[model samples]
Target: MAIIKLSAIERRRLSAFITCLVVAILAWVFTALSNPYKFTVKQIISFKNAPQKRAFHPLQSDTVNTIVQGSGWQMLFSRMNDDKKVIEVDLHTLENRNYVVLSSQLKQINFKKQINNEIIAVNPDTLFFDFSSRRVKKVPVKLITLLKYQKQFAQSAPVSIKPAFVTISGPAEILSKIDSWETDSVVLNGLNESYNARVKLRPSTEGNLEVLPKSVMVNIPVDEFTEKTLEIPVKLINNHNYYDVKIFPQKVKVTFTTSLTKYPDTNEDVFEAVADLDKWKLGGYSVLPVKLTHIPSYSKIVKVEPRNIDFIVKK
Candidate 1:
C-alpha cells in the first residue's frame, strides 16, 4: 500500500464536518419534539383519602374537554390505545368550596410513567361535588313481580325476600325519604312450583346514593287453588223505624277461589252480604245490589248470585 497520511488540517476539517452533521441531526430531532400538539383522551379521576364519616360520590369527575399535550409522535401513540388510565385525586386535600383542582397536583404526579405523553390540560379544571356524610338506614325491600301461573295454581304466600330489608347510605335528606326499597320487576309466567331468584334492587332514589348490597334473594311460594262456594244471608243496614223493609230471596250464593290449603278452613262467616237502607224508597220499585263484605284477603270473589234483590218498603 502506498504510504498516505491525512494532514492535521484535513483531519480537523473532517472532524468539524462530522460535528456539524451531528448537530443538525440533533436540531431536527429537537424541532420535531418541541412542536406543541393536542389530543383528547379519557382519564379516570379517582377520589382518595375521603373523610371516614362522609362518603364522596362520583369516582370520576366528568368526561369533559380533556386535552393532553405532547409531540406529534407522542399524541399519535397515545390515541392508539382507546382505553384510558386512571389518576388519583386526593379528597382529603379538597378546598372549602369542595372543589378538587386536578391540574394543580399534576406536577407532583408521576404522569410520565403512567401515560405515553404529558397532559396539557384536564378540562373542567376543577371538580365540584355535593358531598354529604352518609347515614345508613335499614329499610324494607318491596317486590316488583309479575306472575302468571299455570291453570288452577296461584301464589300461596306473600312475596318473600331473603334480606327483606337493605342497608342504604346516602345524604340525610335522601335517606329520610326512603322508607323502603324495591326490586327490579321479575316476570315469571306459567309458574307451577315454588320459585327462588336473585334480583337486583331498583334504584331507590334518583340522587347519589350507595347501597351496601345491591341484590337480594327472592322466594315466592306457590300452590294449586280450589274453587269453593258459600251461602251468605243478606241483611239490610240503617233502617228507619218508620218503614219496614223486606227483600225476596233473603240469601245469596258467594263463590270464590282459594288456596287448596285454605279451602278447609274457609267458611261463610268470612263474608257478609248487605243492602243499604238509604237506597230504599216507598212505593217505588227498588232493586238493591247485594254487596259482600269481610271477604278473606286470600280468597277471590268470583261472583255473587242474586246480585240484585227485589225489595218492598212499607210504612
Candidate 2:
C-alpha cells in the first residue's frame, strides 16, 4: 500500500466545495417545499349514533380518498404522519334519504390544527348502507366444552353458565331463528379435579347482528367416584295363587358406581327387583330373570348379579 498525504490548503478547498453543494441542495428543497401542491391521502370514517333498535351493515370501504391542497411541506407532513384521521359521521343526523353523502355531511377535515391544509374533495363522496330494524330478545346461553378426565374421575354434576341468558339484538328474521347463544368450543384434557373457566361466546356471522356481553363464566362440577353394592329384595307379581311357586333366591345384589358426594345417599329403596308369577307354570324347569324397576338414571349400574334364579312349583 502507498500512503498519500494532502496539503492543508488542498484539504480546505475540498471541504468548502462539499459544503457549498450541500447548501445549494438545501436551498432548492426549501423553495420547492414552499410551493403549493395537491396530493391524495386516506381518511378514516367512523360511524356513530345509529337509530335505536336498528343495525347498520358494514360499508364497502372503511376509508375515503381525500384530496388535499396545501404547501408541499404541509401536505408531505400530513401524509407522513401515522395518526389515523377520524371523520365521525353521525347516522342519526340524516333525513329520509337511504344513503349517506360523505362530501356533504363531512365537509370539514378533522385533522391536526398544526397542519394547515384544505380538504378539496372526498372520493366516492357518498356511502350506501342497508339498515335493518332490530328487536331485543332474551336467549339462553349454552356451554360448549370437550373435556377429558383422569381415570376414576368424571363430571359429577351438570355444567352451568354464569349468566343463564343473554340479550340479542338483530333483524326480526334473524332473531326469530335463534333460541340460544352458545360459547366457543374449548377442549381440556387430563383434568383430575374441579374445573372452572371463563369462555368467550361465539360471535354471530351476520354483519347486522349484535350480542351483548360477549362472554360468560362456565362452571363444570367434577368429582371422584367409588363403587357401591346394595341388596334389593325380589317380589312376585301377578300371582293367581292357584299354584304355589317359590324363587330359589329371594334377593338380588345391585352394584353401581357413583360419585363420593352421592355415595352416602345411595340406598336400595330406589331399586326394585321383580319376577312375574303368572309367567310360570307347574313342572316348568326354567330360570326366571329378575327385572330391575325404578332405577335412577344418573347412577351407572355396574352389575345385576344372579340375574335369574331357578324356580320350584307345586300343583
Candidate with top TM-score is 1
Q: lDDT tens digits, residues 1-315, model 1? A: 897788999999999999999999999987886687877877766555655566455544346456777677776666687777666666665435466787887774445444646666777778777777678899898898888999999888777788888898877877888888888998999999989889998864333466758999989888888888989999888676756777888999988999888889888888889987776654343688789878877678898897889888777
> Number of clashing residue pairs in every model?
0, 0
User: Model 2, 66-144: lDDT tens per residue?
Assistant: 8877899987788689999766666664335556776665443434333557776788777776666767899999887
What are the runs in model 1 whose C-alpha is more than 4 Å off?
1-50, 55-97, 101-121, 132-139, 162-164, 176-179, 203-208, 242-245, 282-285, 312-315
For candidate 1, which ten residues in a row score worst on lDDT? Answer: 55-64
Kindly give the stretch of ten consecutive residues in candidate 2 with the minimal lDDT sum: 106-115
